[model samples]
Target: MSAVIESHGHDDHHHGPAKGLTRWLYTTNHKDIGSLYLWFSFAMFLIGGVMALVIRAELFQPGMQIVEPEFYNQMLTLHGLIMVFGAVMPAFVGLANWLIPMMVGAPDMALPRMNNLSFWILPFAFFILLSSLFMEGGAPNFGWTFYAPLSTTYAPPSVTFFIFSVHIMGASSIMGSINVIVTIMNMRAPGMTLMKMPLFVWSWLITAYLLIAVMPVLAGAVTMMLMDIHFGTSFFNAAGGGDPVLFQHIFWFFGHPEVYIMILPAFGIASHIIETFSRKQLFGYSSMVWAMASIAILSFVVWAHHMFTVGLPLAAELFFMWATMLIAVPTGVKVFNWVTTMFKGSITYETPMLFAIAFVVLFTIGGFSGLMLAITPADFQYHDTYFVVAHFHYVLVPGSVFSIMAAVYYWIPKWTGNMYDERLGKLHFWLSFTGVNITFFPQHFIGLAGMPRRYPDYALQFADWNAISSVGAFLFGASQILFLFIVLKTVMGGKKATPQVWEGSRGLEWTVDSPAPYHTFTTPPKVSL
Candidate 1:
């Protein structure tokens, strides 16, 4: 009888999640942690969007209408930092936490407790960062890049807080990357060979490697700044015999890979979504894997492209220019594979597919503009201009951000055991698509007309396009609220979803019950291939 009672208690432990707040606080379950990460990232996205709206509002009429120049600088700096580190990167990590285990048929992340720690630390890091706004000297104003002397010598007292916060963020990312690598390497079920794994898993494996390689470099850069600022070192100070340009080299070495780290997972996501809606096998599967590997490898060699105007020798300039352009080859290969997958197929334009299609078209346009900037001579003119701003925003907004939206729409049903409202999902996609193009397309023209970025006021000649751009920015910002609503409503309740959520869906993740049981794969499922 005692043995029987013990067995009953053991069964209770695996039945479902615990009640209320403790479930979130002490849980090691991947799905719960994933939900936490996603919700936190969305909150950050909204906050960052508010900061962006403030900037656009100030830039609306080009006369510093809403904020002081100093405050404007603060908003710009925080906006970039929050959106990249807080919004985009965290969102990708959240997706990884949710999807990677199921894709590989693993019971849970290899380091589940570490996953919990990695996620929980992020809020504190950003809190230290955001709290700086209320301090005496105000928040950081050296721009998100935080080039040396500006960040060290002329920065607000809060720069140290920024450094500390950055360190915490890096630590969180490194821990998360390590978890992904270990889980992928050690936890796959029988017969799931590397090549046979889904593209999303493959994308994340490469991304985890990239994060491990560069996040430390970012931490090291900030550490040097800490020593330079508080300890009187000359890492980036010309007065103390340190070279400022060296700072850019270190930062971009980390920065360029960081860019791929943000988007590689998106490549994985787009492949799955496009294949599902196309009702066809993803074309060039092996080629897609190789293309992603090539992009990750090449990311290391092209860091100097962002510094073309920084007075490097012609030999260095030529090398960096050609290398930057070379990245387009593999990137183009991926694009070709995605497009070819849709050829001669029964395609459906669901919300996920629409976002995937937009990602292909818009990301290519961003890629073309990037090629334009890759010309060393052309970059000299475009450097620090709104053209550069347009180039990256196009890549990030429509490229990385859109792929994330696709994944959310594609998978939320599986997550909640309920299908989202189709009309509302489609509505959200079109509003976002229209708003994204409208907000960013005008910046390309105004940037070409010589409007510099990071300024509070501009010449009247630049007024009209800026006004149009600002209006588009607000439209884009407001539409995100609708997205938030849709996600929340779907989570609460909707039409019941089946185990296989979509008609063409194919993965271990889809084989489970909708809303997935609290503990999945307690006994590893067999993989046929």
Candidate 2:
């Protein structure tokens, strides 16, 4: 087989930016679509962050200052919906779109038409969701978890739209994951066997499986909700012979693994950056892969942990607690491997590495709290409080979002054929780091003090911490403006980059030329590490 990639879709006719607004709509190229997904995700993140600020501002001094209880409920609901569906998930898929082809030595996604469908589904899905805000009863106020009666009988006029929109979004995820799985499995360069693939690829492959498995379950759960609401079937109503608690079972069945799906690719990104900046091989690469797979499989068995407060049988609670606790074991292995990778290595505090290190310390802190929540008795106190809020934000923000930022920093050079503004990048990191810790670290303390989450206001005792948290939230929210500026500038132009953007970076991506062309590795470049 020839080592050189020369045909490169010599006749397929790439559909991407021809220099303006029409580009995003017409594009089918993975990089172009990836950029679209990322920018859209960021836009949703900003919208969601505004809602969070409103929530914080309301709680700062207590007593319904910013809006009514009803309005505050809307803010919380929108914040959760936008952040979950619009921000984290799409960002990871965007990374998959950009990196999968590059890493596997494919020119583009396997099914370009399906890839386009996936990207387009997002805008319409979000439109249906956001439109709910204007309906007579307002957007979903039942919380992001959307438990049974809360989403069915008691839900607003908008629930119908939300259900159909979610169906579309789930279809989009399924199609997107299918494209990625096919691309990686079939399009890998010669000799790039499954086990020999990069950890990032390995992690996403697992995440795709998780997505296919659970997204359908989410679809099923929502379908039941729609049926219970309109047809009076009562899948969740005891009067009609279905149990409300059953909703929690099904929702969390999808929800627990949903959390893993968001963070695993983050693990992949952090591992790559940590190895590169530390000038070391990823510690226990095979073990890292196994750890992720273990987490995915374990995620399915532990869904009941989320429902301990709903009066489960003692035996059920105990079983769920044990299952949830077991997840911590594989998770701990991953944390240890990252730290070991850093140990005695020539570590540099580049922006990406900085974010990766923060992810380790902070996600571990979150994990410890998660394990605490797994205890049946302990969860009684922690169940609906800000502690759960604090735990997940630490995991998702510093853990997943930070990793996304870091990946952008790490790869912007290779993708743009130019180095980003390092000074500005470092400044963005410190601002984000300080703002995040100030924002969430104190919530742990407040949770211990018994402050609950999702409330618009709080008691006087919670005032001082809430005040500090609001400040941090604003700082963090605004700092993203700097990131937007940095990425826009980097893509425009800077110092030229070589094929090997980072000196220690590995894999087939580096074998291709910089700012990789419209087509790449058409003949599947051989990996020779």
List residue ranges in candidate 2 displaced over 4 A: 1-19
Model 2 lDDT at residue 141 = 93
lDDT of 1 at 117: 95
lDDT score, candidate 2? 0.89
Candidate 2: tens digits of C-alpha lDDT, residues 282-378: 8998899999999999999999888888888999999999989998888989999999999999988988888889888988988998988899999
TM-score of each: 0.98, 0.97
- Stretches off by above 4 angstroms in model 1 are 1-13
Q: How many residue pairs clash in each candidate?
A: 0, 0
lDDT of all predictions: 0.93, 0.89
How does model 1 fare in lDDT?
0.93
Give the best candidate by lDDT.
Answer: 1
